[model samples]
Target: MSDEIAVPPRQDNQQWLRWIQAQYGGPACIRRGKRLHDALAQLEQSLARFRQPGHDDDWLAMVRIRLGQLHALAGDWSKLEPLLDADSLRIVQQLYTDLQPQLRLPPAPDPRPDVLRTALQELQEAIAFFNRRWLRHLQSLDLSFYERLIADYNRYYLLEKECLLQSPRLARLGFQPLPSLTWQSLLGRFPLLPMPRLRNETSEH
Candidate 1:
């Protein structure tokens, strides 16, 4: 009745997690759920918001990537411009502008050990809070795009991956159907926030 994942005794077993993820989707059938990307594309296209035709462009996908960059402090956001149309770019710009005030940090204070430790602890807490809220919001996002991708995988992933085997039945061998990806399944792969360096957390003891 619940979507929360249950772990086996050997939780580190990748094969077990993959199998569980596969079985945890919608009832096995071809094309069970609607495609999110196509539906969004149709709506945006009707509004004439897209400049490039015939491209698999999903503005929300781009939005998520850029947002992740902002959170992770990893990539160059300006470089994202050419990948989007003018209107879509405008949306991204406004979003960044709005979030800037909340995300901006006052310059780091004294870099002494005590201050640094406190800062690290506070930053980690903030990330944990953001992680929960971010994941919940993400789960609420349209599943159509990812669902369709998984459905395609459900349909053809094995054949493509195992084509070298050269036997259709062998290609299909030992295959189990994977459902659309769920936040829970993603959680299964990575249950902890990665960056405060989980391993070193115990080193302090």
Candidate 2:
């Protein structure tokens, strides 16, 4: 986006980072993305195409309409970063540190059947503990509003993209809808604490 429409970078605590989208960067409401501007420009072309030749279908009309709606949705978007509640990440990070293997080697499957079974049982308990702890942290976040916008974008982005490209095929290629910001998807941002992997011994032939 040009500096004319550009929003200044915001100052927040070090815990927050911007959402990543390689194709268009952040939301247009925040950065006024280049693709969004291009999409808006297509409205005139769609109107012009409707007036010419044998274009009786509503395809172009919907494309224009979606573009406008998508733009409006984006404009309503404020800084969605810091999307995560403050302190959530820090606590999760500390949890991860506490779960680290530290200097000790991870448990290995033992040759004795009883020892192997005990190790496996302990590992399962640790796995359950990690999952329960992680779930508690994830459930505490409030993603209802941002996720609603993501839901809206998933519904309309492709149609608006078709407007920008002027070709449905072009719009469909390499297109991936933004996922709703669920706790599961948020895992990509905040990682899970994991128990050490069991390294089973292999016999050399």
Candidate 3:
């Protein structure tokens, strides 16, 4: 008798597409990381080559902000983890996961519109949760550290917001910008929280 051949189970187009995405997505993520690293290197070279007189500080500040953004794109959590305690770090980790696709360069041809829409909704939910809980989490921590971490989060958030706004695909997916954080807004939201301790207080104690 002739050997029997094993037939694979049939999958619908959407199922097959999802399978392909899952299989290829890992390498795609690596490629995206490489591209971002390259772009950051190029930006650094440009900054070095075109340092304008009298605008040195401005240029440096802009480049540092861009570097922070690139670090986020690369998922360099080390930059943040040291500044946060375990609970706050966990919140930031989730926020970064949601923000990643929005920050990175878009994949060509894009995912299906439905998939993109669902992702945007999920991202929005993550941001809302972070906004609601982050300040509360900060209240028990060292005030100076809280301010530093919040500042870093705000910078990364601004960069992510700008990327989403600039992407036509993201705009069509109904991405809405999160409100920018400021000292006044932060105080307003958590008015009763004790002021972050001053450096001298720690020194004196």
TM-score of each candidate structure, all chains considered together? 0.30, 0.32, 0.20
Off by over 4 Å in 2: 1-133, 188-191, 196-205
* Model 3: residues with Cα > 4 Å off, grouped in runs: 1-105, 141-185, 188-205
Best by lDDT: 1
Ranking by lDDT: 1, 2, 3
Q: Per-residue error at 124 for model 2, in Å?
A: 12
lDDT of 3 at 61: 30
- In model 1, the runs with Cα more than 4 Å from the true position are 1-114, 152-176, 188-205
Q: Write down the worst ten-residue block by lDDT for model 2.
A: 76-85
Go through the candidates in order and give the clash count of each: 1, 0, 0
Residue 110 shift from truth in candidate 3, angstroms: 2.7
**Stretch of 10 with least lDDT, candidate 1:** 25-34
Give per-model CA RMSD.
19.6, 26.0, 25.9
